[model samples]
Target: MKVYIETYGCALNKGDSYIMMTLLKESGHEIVENYSQADAIILNTCAVRLETEERMKQRIKELRKIGKKLVIAGCLVSSEPALVMNLAPESSLVGAQSVDKIVEAVESPTRRIFLEDSKELITPRVFEGKISIIPIADGCAGDCNFCITKLARKKLRSYPPRSIVNAVKEAITNGAVEIELTAQDTAAYGLDINYSLPELIKDVLEIEGNYMIRIGMMTPELAMKEIDDIIEIMKDRRVYKFLHLPVQSGDDRVLKLMNRKYTVDEYKQLIKEIRNKIPLVNITTDIIIGHPGEDEEAFNNTLGLIKELKFERIHLAMYSIRPNTKSALMPQVPDPVKKERMRIANKVYEDVAYSVHSEYIGSNSLVITTEYGKKGSIIGRTINYIPVIVKDYNKLGDWINVKITEASFFDLRGQLIQ
Candidate 1:
């Protein structure tokens, strides 16, 4: 069988697709690059937002026209299996937790659906680029009112630390220079088991390899729980000094409504502590605009927080009502208001990012070539994970010292400092 897997959403989805491809190949099936050249298509989907779900629906329609067998995987399989079936009636559904059964789904004659909470497996994966995305766990501890994902990924269950360590070891051996420890909330890792993320990192780092690990997004409440230990572990030279901590809102009233356990002050203090210890750490964050009960004052509070924090990167999202979530039932902010808030957030982020990134200009740093850039250039990353685009065709895993020549809100451009 020839299988072409298309992935959507976060790093976890990408990691799942890689595992599925590896499984298929190990079973003597071909993994085709183009969907038109394949006998089956697997869409590892994400329904974190309603907009993303709509896009997935359209893609299913397009793929259905290709006349190949379809397999739907990811959060949609558990949250709304009917959506997948309605979009492509003949499609088989495999939830994120059922990734290990992908081979059976492909070979079985019946329409397969697996959504049980089975033991998480870390199968051998074949990564496409220089970076490898390794999922530390499936699901999370948070029950945010606005999240439909919580329904799909029910309980927080950490994968065995040994399995994760082995996955990282194999990735490093396979020429992966960057490893991403991804999950719904990395801060909540190892809660179910009597283990911790720091312990897992220490074990993985013990492996003899030249690579860096990028920790995924963490909720503020859980971050504070093990923050001291996490900061100590991050001080290791092999870990990138980057933190993605999403502060959904700055207003206490709105946050309470959203079921976020932490206050704005606590989030600010965590940022302060981390920055004080790691002076050059790159702090990124996520913000959702016009969520339920976010009136003019609440939106102002968010803008104020963005100005105060001056995040290195901001993933701004407009609130969208999904099929079944607490926020979806609540009164929604008008579409026009959402659009306006997004504009303000974008402008504020642009100013902050430009100011912060401009300081990197004229600085010289060592960068690892990770991926290709637009228009005959190559993209690399500094120790802090800041992307530096240089005009060259460097090998994927090559490292070079470059002097920063340009800066922008999105990335930095540099010249090889030979």
Candidate 2:
């Protein structure tokens, strides 16, 4: 059978899609690039917000028209299975934790649903280019009021350290130069299994490879517990000097309303500690504008925080109510107010990001080519994960010295150093 799979959402979802594809291929099915060439189609969906959920619904409707055996996979199948059923009653359903059962879901003749949890972690033989995404765990330990992902992945299930180590080894052996350790909350890994993330990193570092390991998003509260250990592990040259610690809101009141567990002061102090230890660490964060109970003062506080931190990257979003979330019951900010706040926040982020990236101008740095960029350019990343684009280089995993020639808010353009 020819199967076509489309994935959405976070790195974890992408990792799951890889697993499904590998499993299907092992079961004598060919993975096709286009939906038109497949006998079966799998749509790995994400529903973190209402807008995303609606998009998934519309996509499902379109794929259903193709009349192939459609299988709805990932978060939507777990969190909103009924809605998926309503949209396409004949489609098979496979939940986020049930990816190991993808072959069953795809091959079953009648309508079927596979929501059972699997304890084993399956490593993908195929990867995206030279980068491999390895999921260390599923679910998280947070109870944030605005998070609908908690409903989809309700429990923290950390894969065994041995399993994860093997996955890393497999990825490296398969010629992956960039290994991304992903989860709903990477710092929450191993709380359920008595293993620690630092320990896992140490184990992975022991693997004989030339690849760089990039850790994924982590909840600040959990990260605070092992910040020092994490920093120590990151000091290794093989690990990317990047951290994604999301400070969703900057006001203490808003933080409390969102049940983020940590205070604004605490978050500030954490950032201070991290920067003090790793000055070149690239800190990226997420900010949600106009969440429930965010007044003008709260929004200003967020803006102030953004300016103060000067994040390397900011993933800004307007609050979108999700069903069954606590925040959805609260009064929403007016659409106009939300839009205006988002506009202001976006401008602030752009200015800060451009200023931050501009500092690299005229600097010489070592970067590893990771992927090809647009118009015959090769994209690479510095030790701190700053993206650099060079027009002359085509080697995909080779390290090259680059002179930073130009900067944009999003990336840096460089010239190869002879």
Candidate 3:
């Protein structure tokens, strides 16, 4: 069977897709790049927000018209299986936890649904390029009122340290220079199994490889517990000096309503400690604008926090109500208000980001070429994971010195230096 797999959402979902493809191939099925060339189509969906959920629904409808054997996979299947079934009753369903059973769904003649919770975390043997995304754990410890993902992935399940280390070793051996360790909350890893994320990173670092590891998003409460160890491990040259701690809101009242575990002051102190230790660390964050209970003062507080912190990168999104979430039951913010707040927040982010990137101008830094960029340029990243686009260099995964020449809010442009 020729199977085409399309993945959406976070790095964890992409890692799951890779595992599914590997499993299918091991079962003697050919994986096709295009849906038109496949006998079956697997749509790995994401439903973190209502807008994303609607997009997934529309995508499923279109794929059904392709008339191929359609398989709905990922969080959408686990969180809203009925809606997916309603859209395409003939489609087979494979939940995020049941990724290893992809072959069964493809080969079985009868329509199938594999939504049962499983603790197994399968590692993929095949990786696509110099970058490998490895899911170290699944689910998270947080129960944020606005998060629908908690409904999909209900428990924390961290993979064995040996398995993750082996996976990282294999990826490096296969020419991968960058390994992304991802999870719903990476810092929450190993809490269920009595191990810790710092321990896992130490194990991976022991592997003999010339690669950089990019740790994924972490909840502030969990991260604060191991900040010392995390900072110590990040001092190694092999680990990227990047930390993603998402502070969804800035107002204490709003934070309480959203059920966030930490206070705004605590978040600020965490940032201060990290910066004091790793001054050059590129700290990225996420902010949801106009969530339930966010009024004019609350929105301004968020804006003020952004200005005060000056995040190197900000993933700003307007709050979208998800089905069955606590925030959805509360009084909702108006759409027009959300839009206006998002606009203001976006402008602030752009200005801050551009200023951050502009500081790199005229500086020489060592960067590892990772991927190709727009037109005839190749993109690389500094030790801090700041993207530097260089022209006339097609080599991937090679370390080179670059002199920063141009900057934008999105990325920086550099010239290869001898």
The top-ranked prediction according to lDDT is 2
lDDT of 3 at 343: 95
Overlapping backbone residue pairs in candidate 2 total: 0
Between candidates 1 and 3, the one scoring higher on lDDT is 3
- Candidate 2 lDDT over 259-322, as tens digits, reads 9999999999999999999999999999999999999999999999999988999999999998
- For candidate 3, list the clashing residue pairs, or say none: none
Ranking by lDDT: 2, 3, 1
Error of 3 at 369 (Å): 1.0
- Please report, in order, the local distance difference test score of every candidate based on alpha carbons: 0.88, 0.93, 0.92
Q: How accurate is candidate 1 locally (lDDT)?
A: 0.88
Which stretches in model 2 have alpha-carbon errors above 4 Å?
none
Write model 1 residue lDDT over 87-183, tens digit each, in one string. Answer: 8888888987888889888888878887786654764578878899988888899889999888888888788888888888888889999999998
RMSD of each: 1.1, 0.9, 0.8
Error of 1 at 328 (Å): 1.0
Q: State model 2's lDDT.
A: 0.93
Candidate with more favorable, higher TM-score: 1 or 2? 2
TM-scores of the models, in the order given:
0.98, 0.99, 0.99
